[model samples]
Target: MNCKLLSVLCVAASVHAASAFTIDYDIPAGNVIVDSIEGDVAKVRQDLRDTKNGWFYWAFRVKGAAGKTVKFVFTDKYGGGPVGVRGPVVSKDGGKTFAYPLDGKSKADGFTYTFGPDEDETLFYECHPYVLANWEAFVARHAADIAAGKMKVETLCKSRKGADVPRVRYGCLSGTPKYRFLVTCRHHCSESMASWVVEGIADAFMADDDLGKWLRENVELMCVPMMDFDGVQAGDQGKNRAPHDHNRDYTEFLYPETKALTEWVMGYAGGRLDAFLDVHCPWVRGQYNEFVYTPLKDPKVYPATEGFFSATIEKLQEGGLRYKASDDLGFGVSWNKGVTYEQGWSSSSWVVHNVKGLKTCRSFEIPFANANGAVVTPEKCRLFGHGVANALRVLMENSQPKL
Candidate 1:
């Protein structure tokens, strides 16, 4: 055999092996920005273009490296590394089913994984991403409810990129002015867990028992599953985007989604909104970020807010995820208290002051994982949501003012 021919074959084999692994980020909320790939290490970072402080929201697919071990190094400046004990979320079968790659590990900088050779593709995300598909599934699961008028899907408005912003409306249409309520989530697309918590609360509202029945008969539960639909679909890090995000788009009401909802609420709600809850997930795990609680605000609203918080905490009886009243962000003592948006006030705060007759308006910071010393699994996340919903039910049943 010619030595020259053998050398050529060796070079060709090496080329094929090197080109085998492919990384893709074309799906919804799929945002893995690969800086470079060298050997078994792929140096990556979160795709953040228009934000002051970049957030960790990445999703990408790895092919050909199924049987090989690889290290993914994230260069994003994270105040806290990947979520709680679970270092990062990975899906062997697309984004339909997700599991913590490093369960309760809390490892950071990057993670090393050796995929099953048989697996054709695997997805990796910063956290368990809940996107449009999950929303559709949750909606479909309650098909009977929609048909029976137990739930109605409303298109709030069209996003900048021509996507429909969906708001789920549940409870009584003839809701007494006192029982009207509104909830919003996913203003920051990276904050995916907030929407899951919302789902759990929605599940509770649609239950069949006395609490569910009463909620259906007497109260109105409206949910904006995702506010920045375009941002979410594009997988943009919307935290502190260039001009303003959905959360800060109030006051002047810049974005279309924010503007449309404002007009709708002004005309439709007419200041009779009993409660308004805006859902968000804070920084990575540890201390304040790992618990579910509302930010402390003016003492004037504390009585009602504290009352509702206490009731919700009480009803959260059995869930693995829990929220304690003591965990509430204090007015001046907490970090959230000092932060302010230069453009305008936040949705919840704006609603509390501008919307008349509004009893309670607050923002909930739900942990991405490792909340209350428990790993935030899909099942536990849903159960925790049920706890939120139960608490909402308790708040409405006994505290409404006479219509």
Candidate 2:
């Protein structure tokens, strides 16, 4: 079928299968693909479109089970960062409205499931649900809130070629003794979903809830929204590229963004910074694939910072994000030891090894393609980010005595 005709059918089919099921892999067609759409539930799939901001959209559907519970699971192949997997939601009024529910779940196995959607209903999510235009508009609408000193924006540092690394710092108050946390996103460039999680964390901070207030009082955050600007804007993989990879450049300080951040950490930190975090998508395949990374097993000879890293992970776990000392490959093991993988580098490892006074440092990997067997989506990402922020807070509070 032609692209237009196929697109129409894909949408129709997605609407037909909203009870329980999932779509697998990147459709790569910029349109939806129905794997199975019949009966009380159907499964659909779609490829992440190569857009300006580089995002993927998953499609959904539901029918005949009005008010009945339903769930879905989604998976992707070319997951980059948290934004790699889109989300799913339902619409009862015939595909005209949507709402997010805490009813879905994700696994470290590359599967995503939303358990309940009444029959004869429609669903929507980040997967084929929204695009760059929507996000840009959202950012635009919140520009004033960000500019009015309520949220501060600054240049973290300049890239190797002198490009400026812009960062957004959000909190309710100023001049408070916050914990001083740093979160960098899109380090690999193509991981666009990292942007969404960054946005979600910022929004949560701005909401000024108790946790947010506590965050404002105990934490000062800095976020480099898009680290690999050139690559992201250019739509290149940005991982394992020639000359230097953004993550690898941390050691040599070659790339402008990496160099800028390295410099910023040295200058902005008053030797009392609490935590440092790097966010990205997992690209590895198999069981230990869809999980977060905390430096557990430090390699034999590489810059062994496992002592500090272990303490930090402990604090992070106290905050709600589950973690373990698995044989997960970390920055030191991959880059410092010359263990070359597709994407091998870590800001967490870089900071723990090089930067002084950064007590709790770690990188979190949210699966985009198949995190624990479920597709990563905006909603899942939001939850994951909250867990991240919470863990950062805990790490901060826990590290106070040492600092």
Candidate 3:
């Protein structure tokens, strides 16, 4: 073939290949129920038609009065790629249009969004939107306490990019041991709310509090903040990658972060972990309260047991965080849908399988754009953190061996 003809054919093939990987958008049939407002997803489906990374997105419109901002919950269906629900994008006209992407920052392990005036508008994601450097700064700011032995910061493992995924732990105790707890956040790079929550828990543990004091004396705490460091830093969703999600990778011990975390839990807990809570934020719409999923098939998992799901729910309620119950939502769903559907392949399930002593293995799904009755914000996230910390205290309390 002539050189010119060959070049034309190559370009044509390239374009065809690019077109083959476009993002596909879809709208599922569901609605989000927030404590602040009733949110129904305008649509639930793949948001992109073509992308090289096999991207799939779901878009939902929150409907409310002119001045009323409503928050909607949307799931990423299944599959395991970078999944997201963009929000806080105001449409001055009801659903006629969207204003802008709720602005945010991408970091090594997650992103943080700045909710706009549309207090009702919000978005959640599974990709990085902030700078990892910011987290490093946070670590630096608190380095003194960590170095002084008041707090602990250790490198659990390094990522594919060679960045270290650090595990932070801090709590002071006084009484006899009762039960222990393990909390992990940001296994999916874009799930930032949990990152902030984890930080809040850290603050509570280090700061003066009766609960913190009690924890130190009676319970042990293990935490891994931001498990998908490389993906978070790169602004990649970090899910559905060639390898697997940081959460699901636990089964094969693939990713450095997941491997490190699994090893840490097994070794440190020594099969005595009382509970394991994997923190995360769900899509833009599901009436789903901050809920827990209990595998219906687990003989050892009695979701109806007095202290199992019931007990955990009670603690969450007391902490001021509302939640509901859901099915296991297993790995099978993940293969058929998008990232959000990648449920069972998580740290939550691993705890159930490996940690025989664990009483509860649950995942906390906070709404990305909105949670409860309103949109998500830093302040609200802080409150969420407090609730989570309180819940941890309660879980330990309930699990304690009688004096």
Could you say which candidate leads in lDDT? Answer: 1
Write candidate 2's Cα lDDT for 191-219 as tens digits. 65566666666665665577677876666
Identify the runs in model 1 with alpha carbons over 4 angstroms from their true place: 1-19, 80-85, 104-106, 174-178, 301-303, 314-318, 400-403
- Candidate 2's TM-score reads 0.58
Report the C-alpha lDDT of model 1 over 1-403, residue by residue, as the tens digit. 6999999999987996775687889766888778888888888877777877756667788888867888777777576444234677888886678888677444666778887878768888777888888889999999998888889998999888888899778877654534777888888878888887788778877788876787787778877888888877777778888787789878777788777777767877775677778889887756687777777776764335555655565555446676677777777775765367566667876676667655567788878877787777666767777776667666666564312
lDDT digits (tens) for residues 231-282 of candidate 3: 5554444445565567777667677877777777778666657667777765
Q: Which candidate would rank higher by TM-score, 1 or 3? A: 1
TM-scores for all predictions: 0.91, 0.58, 0.61
The collision pairs in model 1 are: 85-104, 85-105, 86-104
Q: Which ten residues in a row have the lowest lDDT in candidate 1?
A: 394-403
Instruction: Find the number of clashing residue pairs for candidate 1.
Output: 3
| Candidate 1 Cα lDDT to native | 0.75
* Model 2: how far residue 285 lies from native, Å: 3.6
